[model samples]
Target: MDEEVIARYLARRDAIDQSVDLVVLMGSAVLESVEVAAEAHRTYAAPILISGGIGHSTHYLEGAVRRRDCRSRWIGRSRTSFAIC
Candidate 1:
């Protein structure tokens, strides 16, 4: 993703300052996109809820492994909920 797009997302996230219980990041960019989202969630002091299912476009096991790795990395200090959907 471009830095400009990421900056925009971060700006939007900074505009809100409420407790968030869940965050669902979907689509092809799930691996990296959710990391950025998780950073934003930390800034808001919110737990994260990730939801996405491996589709024909990607290897199911690989996607699941990557998502799990992301969860493990970010699951510290904040509660995390995950569902493959």
Candidate 2:
């Protein structure tokens, strides 16, 4: 990627929307998503809606939480509720 293109992408990506209503965390193998969701919630004071079910990334998600010592609650098998403080 060209430096100018990368800079433009970063500028757009880092732009914050002032009218955000919720922080959504889609279940994935990447633990960084969780961190981002939590941070968003903290910054926006928006409700978080965690979406996903048991899949290839289930174990990875669980492991990531453990590794981070993240406090979380499971709302059945598909949905999870995270309290961002």
Candidate 3:
């Protein structure tokens, strides 16, 4: 793994303004999305918008989110309110 890239990615919020409206999570980022989005909801109190299909991690993500006490609700336009996609 690229430590530099991971460091920069993890530290990305430091450069962004704290005032955010919403967060969108997509693609094959199962656990990462859960972690980030859950943290964002806890920290920012913003709603999460997760979008994606059944990638390899889909079932794992669903199970992970549920295990974390996070719930996934179906939203409009084929989107979801929680971080499982």
lDDT of each: 0.54, 0.68, 0.63
Q: Which stretches of candidate 3 lie above 4 Å from their native place?
A: 1-17, 55-85
Candidate 3 local lDDT, 1-85, one digit each (tens): 9999997886475545567798776655346656777787777788878667766776775676667665644333242335343
Q: For residue 34, give model 2's deviation from the true position in Å.
A: 1.0
Give lDDT tens digits, candidate 1, residues 15-60: 5556666665554433556567677677766666555444554555
lDDT of 3 at 6: 92
Which stretches in model 2 have alpha-carbon errors above 4 Å?
Answer: 1-12, 65-85
Worst ten in a row by lDDT for model 1: 76-85
**So what's the TM-score on candidate 1?**
0.41
Residue by residue across 17-38, what tens digits does model 2's lDDT show?
6867988877786766667888
- What ranking of all candidate models by lDDT puts the best one first? 2, 3, 1
* RMSD, one per candidate, in order: 8.3, 5.6, 5.9
RMSD of 3: 5.9
Stronger candidate by TM-score (1 vs 2): 2
The lDDT of model 1 is 0.54
